[model samples]
Target: MAHGDITHIDIPVSDMARATAFYSGLFGWNIAEMPGFEGYPMWQAPNNISGGGLAPRDDGFEQPRSYVEVDSIDDTIVAAEAAGGSVARAKAPITETSAWAVIVDPDGNHIGLFEGVVGG
Candidate 1:
């Protein structure tokens, strides 16, 4: 994925099955539970390029958020802080080769930053 491009999205839901059914029927998305992430089902858009996950609404993530691909999560975090944004979640590994971080912008919008590619 290119830097600054929306690489993924996380949609907070109260009921995973219900939300999955609705989204799949409405948009024909391919939603399925990943092997390592059983409870959190991931979805691929009809176009097959864009994808996201359906996570339960929780304390830190109570709303939907999009993830932007970046060259380096640490660098992006620094830049975001310099631009008046605050880190919501420090960099955390998503997989052996991939990681993510959450940041709240100056306008209070939550955004995710993704770095590296799984198995890339």
Candidate 2:
């Protein structure tokens, strides 16, 4: 499995409009509302690669989290645990091809692990 770069991050917001405005002003980001996301809007930053999505949160969606792509979800989980982290969501497929899982690091910060659909 070959690890990919961090493609995007998702920021959960209580109010999408307010969050979007704040980020835009704070970072000078050109945030735009995207299709296929319903009411959620995404920001396209200058750097391009580290851009993030902003979505309205509902019940059961607690904590704003970030995702990091890895070569293998299992390997990443093992390393995180060895370094004092714990898995929040065991490695599982989000779709038939793509998989993702969540973990809490030593400091109790949430992170995500993703395995792409097409590649090994």
Candidate 3:
């Protein structure tokens, strides 16, 4: 995917089992915890392409966050800042080569920026 494309979404939930069962049953979504990620249960829509994780809801993270695939996190941060948005979270590495960050738009909406796959 290219920059600005929405690659994933992170849904914050207070009750993991309840939320997982509800979504999976309501939308026919496949939800399960993946290896290496014990607590975060990932969910995929029926289309098989659309998916994200059901993360534990925490302070300052009460809303569902959409992750956009960016060409570069550093560049995205610069552009977001220039465009009146501010970095809510600094770039955090998913692996040695890939990272993710979150920014708050002018209106205070949280948006996630993902830089490629885990090994990319």
RMSD of 3: 1.1
lDDT of 3 at 57: 94
Better of 1 and 2 by lDDT: 1
Ranking by lDDT: 1, 3, 2
**Candidate 2 residue-wise lDDT, 14-65, digit = tens:** 9877898899999877788755456768787877656767867866347767
lDDT of model 2 at position 13? 88
> Alpha carbon lDDT of residue 34, candidate 1?
78
Q: What is the TM-score of each candidate against the true structure?
A: 0.95, 0.68, 0.94
* Cα lDDT tens digits for candidate 1, 27-80: 999999877888999999989999999999988888899999999999999999
Number of clashing residue pairs in every model?
A: 0, 0, 0
Q: Which pairs clash in model 3?
A: none
lDDT (tens digit, per residue) of candidate 3 on 1-120:
777888889999999999998999999999999876789999999999999999999997898999999989899899889999999999998777778999989999999999967654
State the lDDT at 57 in candidate 2.
Answer: 81
- What is the C-alpha local distance difference test score of each model? 0.93, 0.77, 0.91
Residue 51, model 3: lDDT of 94
Worst 10 residues of 2 by lDDT: 1-10
State the weakest 10-residue window (summed lDDT) of model 3. 111-120
Model 3 residue 52 distance off true place after TM-score fit, in angstroms: 0.5
Pairs in clash, predicted candidate 1: none
